[model samples]
Target: MVQPLSDERAPLEGVIEISTGALRGETRDGVARYLGVPYSAAPFGDRRFRLPAPVEPWEGVRDATAFGPTAPQSPYAGALGELLPTVAIPGDEILHVNIWAPSDAAGAPYPVMVWMHGGSLKHGSNALPGYDGATFARDGVVFVSVNYRLGAEGFSVLGGAPLNLGLHDQLAALRWVQAEIAAFGGDPRRVTVFGQSAGGATVAALAASPVAGEVMRQALVMSGPLEAKDPADAGRITALIARELGVEATRDAFAAVDPDRLVAAQAKVLAGSSPLGGGPAYAVAIDDDLVPVSPGDGLSAGASSNVPLVIGTTTEEYRLWLVPSGAVDRITRLHLAIGRRAAKISAAAVRRYRANRPGAKHGEVFGAILTDVLLRRSEYRAADARAAAGAPTWVYEFAWRSPVRELGAAHAVELGFVFDGLAGADSVALAGASAPQSLAAEMHGAWVAFATTGDPGWPKWSTERTVRVFGGAGGGATVVPAPRLDELQELGG
Candidate 1:
């Protein structure tokens, strides 16, 4: 439970009164930090599987000093846990938002950037240390990170339940920011919603949502999948979970089941599932309410047509999954055949990829194909659609290889640099000890600049297919022609 402020007249150091109530924040290094501020009511018991409800009003100033309980998730086992640090405080108060603002607002309405963490839509929490927003605050921006439901609690497509509860949770958080961020010296009009991976996909989906209206002024999608799963696909996963749990795939049954048991059942069902080739068991569903169509198609049809966008993926996003798991060297012709079969791409498509990287190993070729099919191709399609619809779009590719483990600009590598959080050990593990500080400065500055103004210090992506490549072998960022345009076109980008 949130602690109420004492009635005794103590100095109000970092108190800000907003719509719900007053919040007392903590000050650190010239920045005001407010952690675990509830944006919506907890989705447990009677509210399970329902759309997010408004946060109930609270009395007095609530202490927002400590991180809130993260949504329930299965623990990451072994080295994966070390590589991606997650916070898993068990409790129901999971629909919370963390804010980092400059200590001295001075009546300036700073541009606001809302970050959505990525964990394939099943894992992840905002409490991760690397997601700390003090750097953005220090750089003259108000940064807000949110925690939403995950796994079965968030994405299971139960009968008679509202679909995409996690996305709805995000929309609720955005609404909260729009209504109340001004108290923290943030401009509600200058909001930029940005995220990587699943969060990135959420950003795109939100932009395409009919309810978005003028709520979001801009968006940035980093390594987020653009294609949403069909409703039938979501149903299959729900049925699979239901079969495993020995219950009906309905909201009442799921709500009655133990939450932990449901989470464990979801893990078991998804253990052998592959996210490649549109096989995500739990992801954004193509529900007409929140996501009316494929995000790519919506962008083409002028959904959020006025919202500018920054969209891109890492140069080798698949390496993050393949390299650490020792699956790269083990990939064989059978694996390629399976991937090709799943994606329904022709042998000519495989030949094109192989020709581009002459003498590449079958595993390397397989990883590249997955990277393009699952990430890069979708990014290109979304960007092209948005640009065609007259929304200014900036495209980029993070090409910096991790000096630590040859991770080669894998998915989520640019996160530390984006947040200007290279000092953290978790960050160093992915970015390497000798990661260039200059690149972080440049990339972070560009994000800030984009939030402030609708440009990211590069020419817009047009028919020229221009992209800003950050951190190549020589240790500097560059603006270059986008590689694999033909491959993307072949993949129907």
Candidate 2:
């Protein structure tokens, strides 16, 4: 009943105080934004590859008018690059955070949402215009987007260094939010953390962590994998990168290599890897303290069961990987067989998908099957487990098919809508010129509602498995009793 960027008030707002000192940001369209605020110490010199350290206290109000550097990483390669826009800022102290809040600042203490972006744990930053928090701030929420170490410096498991440094960095940022968000008129107790893809997967891992209750009140995992690898399995990617750099797979040896060079090697080693057959890609690893097990397994086992959660996937997540690269066309019957075997998909699942999508090519069928195995099914199992424990969980699907590139509700297409950043160039690159504002409003409103009230205007997931389908055929939103219940059930997730 009651509510609520730069594109639409004034500029150069005022100062807000925190533990570090003071920050001066701008107010545009009634939203005050503090950009490029450091939440951790610089990870260069002797600190490289170590756990995130506390930020040194400042002497005066630091200028937070511009975004800080992004984590060291490479841009998307090939056709994927053309479709996904990336921002690459330089420097070693990339552990930063961006914030947006209502200019009036305080009332009931606005609901807070912290964003972790998805880029295979190697790409993306809070600086991207598409990740801007202005819209969220305008809607009565204090929003944050965090930049953590990535690639070798963050995720690479090495001798003499902590594993999952990336996740640890995020944990540090959350701790900072809990301590300092009230300065920006944000309620520390009402924090809701959400992310897409790799970011989403990280959110799941965090939800399963013992410290989850100390930081965030809720979590939303969007189009993310649910698996965690053992140290040996997860470190395989690091070993390959070390081999490429001609060094021992240890913290000291990698500390000598330039971040850009390591990023280049990361791209080279990961090249030609498909979504299904991508051998040893970066993923969250099980550790004794942070994430003790895979999120899917841990979550289904009732870890973090008290955390209200929302989990969903785009209708065609794999199509984002397969369609633009022309890989979809090259898929054949043999490829399907190998994929089915590797994914453990049953013959019944294959036949079920084919029947559901009549006249579908082999690539289409394969993409559908791969999406379920790699994404949808695991999330469903997590939700089902939480539901059985009497925990509140909600499910939804981004079904709006993008006209550009025939991406049918593909991965990341929902992001522009979710953030209400459809006009942003990065979003338009995938969603195209003529996207729908009403649809964006619908999805964005739901996320806001979820953050504000823990109810996204939809039924809670239960034995019924109700899912709200957002912005597909006939437009607007619809609540359905499991849109593809038969196919999903047949898939045996």
Candidate 3:
């Protein structure tokens, strides 16, 4: 447990010395904020599409009062973009971390929680307005959010470049935290790395990484896919994009393309892809050197089994993509038949879903199948495997429905509550203006509690598969034994 800070709050304006140099930070809302601080050197020029190089030592205190440049990427397009907002700050120095520390918790070693923002391995950054870390800092924790390489720049398996460059960037940031967070009054030993969607997948992989020992103390995966692709399968996306650019699939060839042009070609190649059906999309891949095995295989088979873990999903994840695009309204019965075969869903299982979800439309039912197939089942299997391995694991389900665009308890709907950003405009874009604050308090409090102590105020996953449910038809947070066990078993089998 973190010791309480003295009643006297530390002065807000201050300079903290990290390894590279001293950084001057600003104060606001009783929190000390150091924004856009480079944890690694800019990955450009000779270093483009390569492992992150160390940040060169600076001469004077770097101006860190505002957010730094974000990784190169385009905005989320069309209707989905409307709900999930993004920032595109241009620059070569894109490997940065934004930090918020409690001014009142000075001199005390507060637990640190580092955030990984999710963007499907393509979009997102530390500069998103709703991702402010002040709330965690206010609650007596030092919070840090990281930005890494994305899309081809980060994930592509190239001929002469490292695999998982984005993941490597994240590891570098964690190493930086281990070396520097102490000066910010943080306990590096109590670090908890947590994230949503792709970010969640990232932490899962990190937990199983052979190098995870000294850097991270805990792991949390929220609605993140746990599968890692085979190198050849993963490289196919890069090959397609390279073909789109009429260039060879190699580091030198990709490095020659303009960053903007590469992402544009990537978008065009993936325009027809969807969560349910599509060609290869960018994802974490299995590499003999780094991710020797997939996270699910690693976690279940004892990799990082000793690490405390919290993994879960929203009730209706597929709605995030399906509803916004009018696909739900357009789904036909024939489409359901084809999806069942493609996703390997048994006819009996489809019948069960139809019966259980009485009055549900064809698209809604099919969407549920895709959600189970793509997301929910992955978390379920990971939790079960962790249980068998005798690891401490907590499972949760975010069931809060959003009135906006009928995105009921969708993939990222719980983000507003988790970050306690109901009043923020970014939160409003996804969740309606009247989203509940009580749920936010309960969920956020549970997270703070988990980071402070290994437990999330819920029973550990075991024979019962207990889950902490947040905001469903049942208004308050509750824990249920083996929720949806039968349905999950059918999907898994």
Q: Considering only N, C-alpha and C atoms within 3 Å, which residue pairs clash in candidate 2?
A: 9-28, 9-29
Superposition-based RMSD of candidate 1 using all C-alpha atoms, in angstroms? 1.8
Better of 1 and 3 by lDDT: 3
Residue 419 deviation, candidate 2, in Å? 0.6
Q: What is the alpha-carbon lDDT for the whole of candidate 3?
A: 0.87
Ranking by lDDT, best first? 2, 3, 1
TM-score of each: 0.96, 0.96, 0.96
Steric clash pairs (candidate 1) = none
Residue 430 of model 2, lDDT score: 86
Q: Compared with the true structure, what per-residue lDDT tens digits does model 2 show for residues 366-470? A: 988888888988888988999999988999999999989888789999999999999999889889988899999999999999999988899999999999999
Candidate 2 is scored at a TM of 0.96
Tens-place lDDT digits, model 1, residues 1-493? 4456678835476877878887889998989999999999999988889999988888777898999999988866554566777777878989999999988868469999999999978889999999999999998899999999998888888889988999999999999999989888899999999999889989989988897665789999998877777878866778888999999999999898998898888888777454553454677899978898988778767788788889988888877777776777788988898888877887888888889988877888888888888778777776777677677888999998886566888888898899888988768979877778999999999999999888999989887889998887667778888877877766766
- Candidate 2 C-alpha error for residue 152, in Å: 1.3
